[model samples]
Target: MARRGQYAKGAAKRAEILAVALDVVAELGTRKASNREIAARVGLTQPGLMHYFSTREELFLEVLRARDERDHERFHSPQRGFQSFLDVIAHNASVPGLVRLYVEYSAEATLEGHPARAFFEERFVWVRALMTEAVRHDQAVELMGPDVDIPYVVDLVIAAADGLQVQWLLDPSIDMADRLARLWQGVRETSWPAVAT
Candidate 1:
């Protein structure tokens, strides 16, 4: 019983650390949110905080994961179709720091053996599935045509969204959400050739 209580406390502390780290990253941007700073805010020494996470990369990756969880709760709904995605894009505009963190971390995670590589790979698969479902939902309700190539549409949407994030980081004036919405609109309105089996 005592061991179980200690495990519960450890899990709770880890969660609190992740939550604080998320707020720090969201407010300071990844470049500014150092491990020391995050540790200070969480009332732990840097090494003490390291006890909760295996590595610096793991902690930062957990911050991104926490952000995803919040975004999923706030913006995603299977029945909402593409509009839910747009909502997330719009919301991202308000949190440029988190967007910057995502862009940088995702790029770094592309390298072999990077701690975040598996997380990003799984995340992309999950995102693709979610977007595919949204596209199919739209087609069922006539928002998009039945002729639409689901795989192509899903890939294109993901590419555009990821590209727009980089462009938006470079130029704050660029309306990422608006541009993505327009792209999605064009995609839905156009008749796509059926894919060969």
Candidate 2:
């Protein structure tokens, strides 16, 4: 149908815009990247860009969404598992903008009735379930303690990862990937003392 074709083209255009915006953010950093600059770099007029994303906030939020989709593809593809999550987190640290933009956008989304609120609220639930499932499986398979506090431990790890992201964004010297790997090692080592060493 013509309508379906139009929607597909629109989605592809939006994806192109996001890819260009990511490069702009990577070069200019999130604080200095502007919608006008992104549009110019992407060979679109500001209004043309607005056709895909009505507002600058919406555009950047959608950029964040694109980043999430990229993560899913690269990290949680057809054969996803616990190691994939760890690998993704480690890989995510290499792109400071990705994590920083996500956190910044999430903070804005916390405001009531914000355009990005649903996006982030749903993202939270998705991430929580993912962590719960991954941790539960690891525990069940004897990778972690069967008696461990599943929800509490998973929450702590997620909090630590997010917290480290904030800190790393504030100061890249923190070595986010190293800290993340160390946290994983710590948990695994603690739970499975025999094989850790």
Candidate 3:
């Protein structure tokens, strides 16, 4: 019984730490948001904050995970189809700091044995599945053609979105959401049939 109470308290503190860290990252970007600053904001000493997270990388990973959870709740719905994805992309433009964090962390995660490698791996699979389902929903409603290649379209959409994030970070004028929407429009209108044998 006592252990359960301690666990609950620990969970609550972790949640509070994550919430403060998210705000710090959003405001300061990953480069500027030092662990000291985050710890201070959360009323914890640096060592105390480290007690909650195994390492600095793990803390950053958790921040990204928290962002994903919030976005999923806000923008994902089976009935909304691809529009939900578009909405999320559009919303990202407003959070440049988080975008930078995601881009930098994801790049780092590609290296072997990186702590975030598995997180990115799982995230890719989950996102692909989500986007595939959205594409199917669009096709079922005649928003997209039956001939649309679900797997190819899903992969393309994910690639485009990820690429756009990089481009948008370089040039804010890129309009990630609008560009993706246009790409989606083209994908929807075209009938992709097998070419020559």
Candidate 4:
């Protein structure tokens, strides 16, 4: 095993490469992104780059994981509900390339033996659990009625978020954040009776 210092250095180098690779991929679509190009930007030869990532797909998946980590840290908070999710959707609007990469890989990972399959699977499971918790939180706070079906509401929220990304990708004019907020208002109004004076 490598010494602690060596391991830390290796990890730092990996992060550097990932950062450069993300930018390179953002500039040139993923389809056109080459390992050699990434290596050149990061001051490494193609073979040196391969030492860090055994395959192109491996490197791409690492980028996806890196992006997810960044997003989680940036948007995640104790608050969990429709409005919190709206902020996330609005944040996503600023990173179009990363959004495209995620959407594409998620669809491709559905195929057997894909490298990103496990990542996408775990992501979906985690998101569902988070959404369920959010719904429960809303109920506890009376923001959402306890009588509402939590599972169904969670499913709808996840489905709407994922579907909105696809639609927004196809048409930049789509206001995903606003649409979701409106949906939330509708859900709230229909799920709970209005307070009477």
> Over the full model, what C-alpha lDDT does candidate 2 score relative to the true structure?
0.77
Point out where model 3 deviates above 4 Å.
Answer: 192-197
lDDT of 4 by residue, 130-185 (tens): 77766677778887786777677777877888889999989989999999888776
Off-target runs (Cα >4 Å) in candidate 4 are: 193-197
lDDT of each: 0.88, 0.77, 0.90, 0.81
For candidate 4, what is the TM-score? 0.86
Clash-forming residue pairs, model 3? none
Top candidate (lDDT): 3
lDDT (0-100) at residue 66 of candidate 3? 99
State residue 139's C-alpha deviation in candidate 1, in Å.
0.7
List the RMSD of every prediction in angstroms.
3.3, 3.4, 2.6, 2.7
The CA lDDT at 110 in model 4 is 96
Ranking by lDDT: 3, 1, 4, 2
lDDT, model 1: 0.88
Q: Tell me how many residue pairs clash in candidate 2.
A: 0
Q: Which portions of model 2 show Cα errors greater than 4 Å?
A: 1-3, 77-81, 189-197
Instruction: Output the better candidate (1/2) by lDDT.
Output: 1
What TM-score, computed on C-alpha atoms, does each candidate reach?
A: 0.93, 0.83, 0.94, 0.86
